[model samples]
Target chain A: MAEMAASGESPEILFWVGCAGSFDDRYKAVTQAFVKILNKVGVSFAVLGPEEACTGDPARRAGNEFLFQMQAVANIQVMNGYNVKKVVTACPHCFNTIKNEYPALGGEYEVIHHSQFLQQLINEGKVALKGGGEFKGKKITFHDSCYLGRANDVYEAPREVIKALDVELVEMKRCRTKGLCCGAGGAQMFKEPEEGKKDINIERTEEALSTGASAIAVGCPFCLTMMSDGVKNKEREHDVKVYDLAEMIAKDMGI
Target chain B: MSILPQLIFLLVFAVAGYILYKRVSYLRRNIFLGHKEDRNDMKEQRWKTMVLVALGQKKMFKRLGPAFLHLLIYVAFIVINLEVLEFIIDGLSGQHRIFAPFLGGVYAVAMNIFEFLAIAVLVSCFAFLIRRNIMKVDRLAMKELKGWPALDANLILIIEIVLMFAILTMNATDQILAERGVDKYLAVEGLFFSGLIQPLFQGMSEGALIFLERFAWWFHIVGILAFAIYVTYSKHLHIFLAFPNTWYSNLQPKGEMKNMSEVTNEVNMMLGIQTETSNDPPAEIGRFGAKDVNDLSWVNIMNAYSCTECGRCTAECPANITGKKLSPRKIMMDVRDRAEEVGKSIDSGGPGLEDGKSLLGDYTTKEEINACTSCNACVEACPVNIDPLSIILQMRRYVAMEESGSPAQWNAMFQNMETSFSPWKFAPTDRFNWADQLKNEEAK
Candidate 1:
């Protein structure tokens, strides 16, 4: 945000590189993949870089409303100072909090999840889906993230992006409104499970595996982590691969 | 009219009225334990919600079978109470069939309709009893429904069935008495269900028929009074509370969380968006989130009182399905129980506010609260629109801010968010490094 203000030039959109995108080793690949897609399409977008803060989704969800408001206020102040109007984020938590919660704190922006944004770029003929991609005709199932699918009601955009890859899309028994959580929401990603009969991620991953798909597609970073960990736990990491929707699109483009 | 029976009737009625008043007052005081919140906005929408949800049984019909059965009891319970007004007047004035002379044929029509509903109520109560006991529905068998809740459900169903039977038997015996030309016995016909059972009293002595008539009459009226007071103590309280609970329901979008203005004001002051006045004293920071019943909003207390303990929320909860400790029904039950405890302490002139126990520690544990995913499934599944998530969030606030008892991993995340502006130890300058890598790869 500061870089844009000092340069006296504005990008068409601001890419919100959330905490996981910025630092988590596994999700950093997703960040790189989404960036490649943006560059390939020649879309003008800038990152907050050192000026960005966590959107406080985890803090607020974990019951620290005070900390959440503080973090939200700081980020809103910086973004407002830059006159930032549009934002696109790969993380649904950030997408949800900023799009829904930030407006009450005086920070309003036209926020879009990366899946929807990618679909829009394709719809506008800005990005082309080349035939014979790596996932062409491959069986891929999508796991709906609680925040993205249930909370925000964006079920079709990510699936549409997968369809654009020329891949056969399968679905788990519990999809869309009835989709089970990946057990990583509500800040549970930062803590240990509190003594359950079975881990929720394992149960959800079992449903994904039952679809006989070779790859799982995800829209949110938290779902990616949980689904990937579930695949690893089942020792099917060799058989099944978990790819974020952006990564599959980037790989298919040969970027 | 005999003065002796009239005086006896007055004494019995006063005792029941006193008991009913005491229980209702107790409930009112317990509900007021929480802090005030204004849910009076959007009056038109609130009225529509109450009518559709509580009156029309809109949400209940999601499952057709249970909805049909519950509607039978709900409709009968409401319509049959109209008969109670006639009973009160007849019992006090020593009159038999007082409305019979005024309405003439309409009186028999109304009584016929009441008889049919009485049978429907009896059948529905039996079906519900079997569902709770013999069939053993899975939701009814959850851990939260054990002991008192389980027994309370069976007890109420049995009482309702008995009350309906009393009505039928009273009408049947009165028909027999009228046939024999007994005094003060109106020869009313078209009694439907009761008329079918009139043969059981045939060939019996007149004195025995009159005795049975008076017994069933007194039992029906007195039983209704007891049921009224008992409802205040049981989960059946939803019969009365579901209306107002639906009225004060949250009208915001399901995904939107209500922002705490107190925290917002502090944030605005810190951000220099709103300057604090020099005359204003430093704001005293209270406990961050709710710690007890008194800290929660009044709507939350109302939600607690309005919970039906049906376990539908728990049945749909992903956490419960995955075997987590969290049961949304249990959370509401615990809140109501704690509120009752605090209210009773106050009635006894003891330390009510400082009961040395709280809704957080003594009742609900952190394990259950943490197990929640905040998915809003429970809130959506509730027929009365009770938002268990609100209470869960507030209790979690207490755990996070007041006790600082969150897991070490969460504390690390909090620390990371504090210094690095992210939930990681990396510097924010490296945030866009992924884009830089993409540019280099493309240049190749």
Candidate 2:
């Protein structure tokens, strides 16, 4: 981002909060801090319009191919019209679709899920980290989102982000590749839940709780909501808190 | 001087000729019977399947014994038709004997050979009728055994066998008349029955024997002509539909059935399924890919028209064998019927395939398509090789991509894919955990 900015032309990493991040203020605050860092480094960025609607990912899944194409094409044109090619989003589904599905519809761009983009900054030492605020005592558990892990084949960046924060990253039995769903995909957020054998969010939340972590740190807006809900509903509200990865990192960096 | 007999002979042969022409034309143009398919590699398949299957009639003898039965009948039908022409021409032309340029004697010997073979062919057809109609064999289920009129099959068999016998009887009668000095054998002199009939003929007169000779010839000719016309209208229609259907058959495997991807627009979907109440959108409208039978691709209709009702498709389909409600053959028939029905509503100009609606909902429902393992068994096993799997999958793609009506799990997964770049719904920050195990190795 800094290199793109340092060049004579204008360069901005379009920071997309996505629907999931919009509802979580902590995520918003941390994400804004990252934007502040970019600005301080003289790198430019723009957030999506607050009213930015969905990119039609849920509709595509429901066999609404028409809706998916329209949403995808419209979104791509919007992004391109800004002359922006680089994007960062907290939601992996948004990130993957913009990066992968959009290409099928002739919408191509360089997209990075935020965890990945942030890890690169840390590895390059481009962003300043606090020297005294070490996460030397906290045990943190990481949750992998389907979009980031399976869709984009990103599996290491988030762990590296937490390791940089010096937090002990723990795992639930259903971590990494075999991770269970949080029951919030496929536009299920818009529709009422079906009577499944068990609430999927409750099951996933318990899996995280079982890890005995002080906090369940996540990367997606939907996973953040579901896991936090899972923590509250399981009465583990006092023991485990769900923090978006950005919130965890920005705080560990003393920003 | 009798005109009745001669009239019948001319009329029947003409009708047979007419049917032969119409059936060939219908099979060719309607069913894509002779289309030269442009496809990927299959030079050998073209040779063995395209050339060999129709000409060699290899399917007839796949089971040596049963193959022998059909082969005998098929060969006999072709042979006997030769004499049918001779019988008609001689009866109408005031000729006492069938005209053969080189070998009158050779023709007689062939008639005798044809007579014995006719009996064998008749028996085989009769057995097929009984097995298919009376016994209701499961093997023939793919073929519509109904509307087949087993009686017509019997009638054809009986006519062939009886006509040959009548030839024998008429010859016997002629021999007796000649022996009585009633008629002349001209070629073969002093034949047996001619002598016995002479004593009685001395009492009767020459006019009577001559009249009897004329009667036998007319009866033989009239019978052949009547049967010829009947065969044309019948399922012996395959006599025509099979050749081109075999030649122009779909070359693709069932699974890859091709149809344009129905790319549905997102803004339109948020509006929901279109109805009469739908206010027109501000922009150009997009309707469903296919709205009714006329909306279906012409290839679908062709599949239906080309069916010879051989039942080979159904016999090999695992779904039909497993007692599923799906029958690929029935699907073809229904598609044909619906296309015709929908065609009635279309302009005479004939609409394109995309303009017609699919019959997928009526016969092969979404459940059926989903249930299919996408196995290409049906396409491979088909004698004509229509690819049903492609049609099934295309429908699924339309439903999934356009309708957005899939199970919620996949929707959730898709949502995950859109946001997280993977199908499993998860936190974007945690996307990199799969690399954790490989990290140490990468460092080395």
Candidate 3:
């Protein structure tokens, strides 16, 4: 943002690198993959760099309205200062909170998830993929993130992006509107789950793995983390791999 | 002396009407005990949702077999009530088959349809009974429904079966009497189900037939009135509440939790941010979240009443499926139960919300609310659009803000978010370090 302002130039969009995309070691690779795609498509974008703060999704969902508002107001201030008008993020948590919750705090912008952004790029003939990429004709299962699918009704975009890779997509028994959670929402990711016979992440992972797909695709950073943990728990990490939608697209495009 | 039956019927009808009125008012008063929530926007959308979800039974169709049987019973409930309208008019005007003379053949066709639906209701109720008892469907057989709830479900089915029999018996005996050319009896024929039972009444004496017919007529009307009164108390209230419940459903994207405007204003003031739309008076800081029934919105309370304990929500709940303490259905049941408890206490001049017990500890435990992933499967699974997750979040808000009672790990996480703008202890400056490697890769 500072460089753009110093050059008296305005970018077309702002890349919201959420806390997971910025700090989580595993999710940072997803952030890089998505950025490479943006560069490949010649989409002018600016990042907040050091100025962005958390969107307080966990704080609000954890029931701390005060903390949530504090974080929201602070973030709104910086974004408004930058005159940011369009934003995209790879994290459903950040995507949901900022897209839905920010307007009320005097910050309004058109926000799209990375899956939707990728689908648009593909639709506009910007990002072309290899006809016989690694995922071509291979079975891949797409796990619906609660925020993206049921929360905002963005079910088809991510699946469309995956189908563009020329792969056959399989569905779990529970998918779409009836999609199950990965046990990490509502701040459950940061706390020990209450006593239960089995963890929720395992239950969801078992369903995903039961689809007989060698690869699982996810849309949210939180879901990616929980599902990866579940795959490791089942000791099937060697057999099955998880990739974010952007990562898959980036890999297919050879960006 | 002929007016004696009409007089008695009038008295019975009056008493039943009075009881129904009282119950409806009681329900209204209790539902209004909660705070107000404005859901009246998007008028056209609300109607469309009500039509698709409540009237269309759209969500119930998620499971095929039960949904089919439920459709049968639901259709029976609607079509058979048209026949009840005839019964009501007959009992009031000292007439028999009043609509029969007016519509000529249409009445017989309608009665035939009613009989077919009555038979359908009987068969569906029997299937449900078997599913609930012998088949032991996992959702219906959960421990949450062990006692009164279980009995309530079975009792409703049994009552519906008995009511159908009453209607069928009246039709059958009336047909037999009509064959004997008795006065005030319609000479209806070609009745499908009733015809099958007509032979059972063939050998009866005229007076015996008359008495049996009169007895069934009175039994049918009175039982119908009694069922109306009983439904308000039973989970069967869904029949009525489902319409309004679906109408007032949360229409925003399911991912968006409502922002607390009071907190927003306070935060803006603390930050010294100026805004143009600050004309409203400074808001008072009410309870941060729902601590009891009254702290919740009226829509939240009504959601509790609209739930029918079908266990669809519980069955789909990841926490419950994983053997956790949280059952979304039970959360709704608990809220309704607590609302009733508080409403009753206030009626009797008791301490009401001050009765020392709460929805949190006494009805729902901290464990149950904490176990929720906010996945919204339960919300989506509800045929009537009951939002148990909203109530759960409200209570969690109470625990975190009012009592500071979240678990230790959550408190640490909260501290991390407050201090470092993330749930983990990482400096905000490192937020962009992930891009450093990307820069290096690009340089190559």
Candidate 4:
């Protein structure tokens, strides 16, 4: 973004590499997969790189409104400095915070989740899927992130993208608006869950496993990590794989 | 004189009306004790939401069987209440079937429809009771509903059944008297449900039939008045509040937590940034989040009262489903409990919120609030759009901001977020380090 601004040219969109997409070892792959799709499609997107900051979603949700505003204001200033108008992110947390919460704080943009962006790219015929990818004919379950599904009502876009892979989409008993949480929301990823009969991720993963799907697709970085941890807990990691929708799309497109 | 019965009816009606008014006024006063919020925007969307959710029972259809049963009761509640208007007029005027004279045959048809609705209400109430007691539906049978909530659920159903019986019995005896050519018994026709039981009164004499019919009449009307008063104190308050609650629902996306403009101004002033200009003075930042009921918004308090305690929220709650302490239903119940406690205290000329107890420690626990994943399944599951998550978030805010007593791990994450831009301890320069692998993949 800084280089583009220096050259007096703005990219088509600013890729908001959220904290998970940037720093988390596992989610970084989701970031890379999505970027590969973007590059292959020639979308001319630029990341904030070092200039990006947390959207204060976790802090705000944790009830530290002061910290949340500080982070939101700082991120807003940086994005506004770049004249950033459109944003796309793989993390539903960042997407929700920026799209819904930022407008009240003087930051507004056409924010799109990577799943929606992928759906748009596919509809426009920018990204094409192979006729017979490794996932074709195999059963895959899509876990709805609370932020993306119930929060924004973006249930269909992600499912449409998954169906484009030519894989049979199996739904958990609890799916769409009634989808179970992976238990990483509201800063639960940073801390241990309260004592319970079972971890939420395990509960969610069991639902996914019940569908007999070989792959569990997710839209949020937090969900990806939690579902992956859940698969490991069940020792089904060797058979069942958890992935972000972007990663699956990128792999299907052979990007 | 015949006016004697009229006088008794008037006295009962006035007393019940006054009691209901007092209860309603107390509820309104307690709700307003919470801080104000501007939900008046988006009149069109608010109307649509109220119509669809509260009026149309849209969300209830997510579960077909219960939704069907609930719809029967809901429809009966609305249509049968039209008869209450007639009952009120008859009670005050010392007349029997006042509307009967006005509409003639139309009145009998209306009466038949009302009878059918009464039977529907009876059937629905019976099904609900069976589901609660015999079937032991997990959601309704949860530990949160072990006491008054459980009794309250059964009591409302039993009352509705008894009320329906009163209506049916009143119609049956009135039909019997009209058959015997008694005066003022007003002839009616096509009363299906009540007519089915009319034969039981065939052998009764005139005086006995009149007494039984009059007894049922008083019972039906007085039972309705008492039910109206009792509803204000019960979860059945949802019948009245569901409209306003759905109208004033948070129209924004479910994931969007409310922004604190007060915090925004403070942050701007501290950083020397120009805040948005407004003629009104900067609002005071009272205790950060809600310590008690008063610190929350009026809509939040209304949400508490509007909750029907159906346990749909608790049933779908991820935390509660996993055996965690956080039942979203319990959160609303706690807020309502605390508000009622404070309201009663102030009424008695005692310290209200300063009674050495808070909603946090005394009513709801930090364990319960902390257990929430903010998954919003509970919010989505609410038929009337009661947002228990908002109350949970407010309590969480109180814990974090006022007490600075978030769990130690959360405090560490807060510290890390303060120093670095992220929740982890990584430097900002390394934020895009993950993208470096993209260039290597491109090289391949």
Candidate closest to the true structure, highest TM-score: 3
Q: Quality of candidate 4's docking, in CAPRI categories?
A: high
TM-score of candidate 1 against the unseen true structure = 0.89
Off by over 4 Å in 4: B276-280
List the candidates ranked by DockQ, beginning with the highest: 4, 3, 1, 2
Q: In model 1, where do residues sit more than 4 Å from their true spots?
A: A1-3, A32-44, A115-142, A149-177, A211-217, A236-255, B3-15, B92-113, B179-190, B264-285
Model 1 alpha-carbon miss at residue B340, Å: 1.0
DockQ values for all predictions? 0.58, 0.06, 0.83, 0.85
Error of 1 at B53 (Å): 2.3
Query: In candidate 4, what are the lDDT values of residues A1-255, reduced to their tens digit?
Result: 998999999999999989998888998888898888888889988888988889998888888999999999988988999999999999899999999999998899999999999999999988888949999999999999999999999999999999999999999999999999999888888888898999999999999999999999999989998999999999999999998989898888877
Q: Please report the candidate that would top DockQ against the real structure.
A: 4
Candidate 4: Cα lDDT at B283: 74
Candidate 3, residue A165: the lDDT equals 94
What is the per-residue lDDT of model 1 for residues B337-401, given as tens digits with 9 covering 90 to 100? 99988998998998986978999989899889988888777886799989898999998888998
Worst 10 residues of 1 chain A by lDDT: A1-10
Any residue pairs clashing in model 1, and if so which? none
lDDT of candidate 3 over B1-444, digit per residue (tens): 387878888899899999999999999988998898999999999999999999999998999999999999898889888887887788888999888888878878888999999999999999999999999999999988889999999999999999899888999999998888898898875888999998898998999989988988888889889999999999999999999999999999888899888787678888898766567777666798988998899999999999899999999998999999999999999999999999899889999889999888999999999999888889889989999999999999999999999988888988998889888899988888998897787799
Ten residues in sequence with the least summed lDDT for candidate 2 chain B: B253-262
Q: Residue B256: error of model 4 in Å?
A: 0.9
Question: Native-contact recovery for every candidate?
Answer: 0.63, 0.11, 0.78, 0.81
Cα displacement (angstroms), candidate 4, residue B34, comes to: 0.5
Report lDDT (CA) for all predictions. 0.88, 0.58, 0.91, 0.90
Deviation in Å, model 3, residue A87 alpha carbon: 0.7
Query: Which ranges in model 2 have alpha carbons more than 4 Å from their true place?
Result: A1-255, B2-4, B13-48, B59-65, B141-236, B252-255, B259-299, B339-370, B390-444
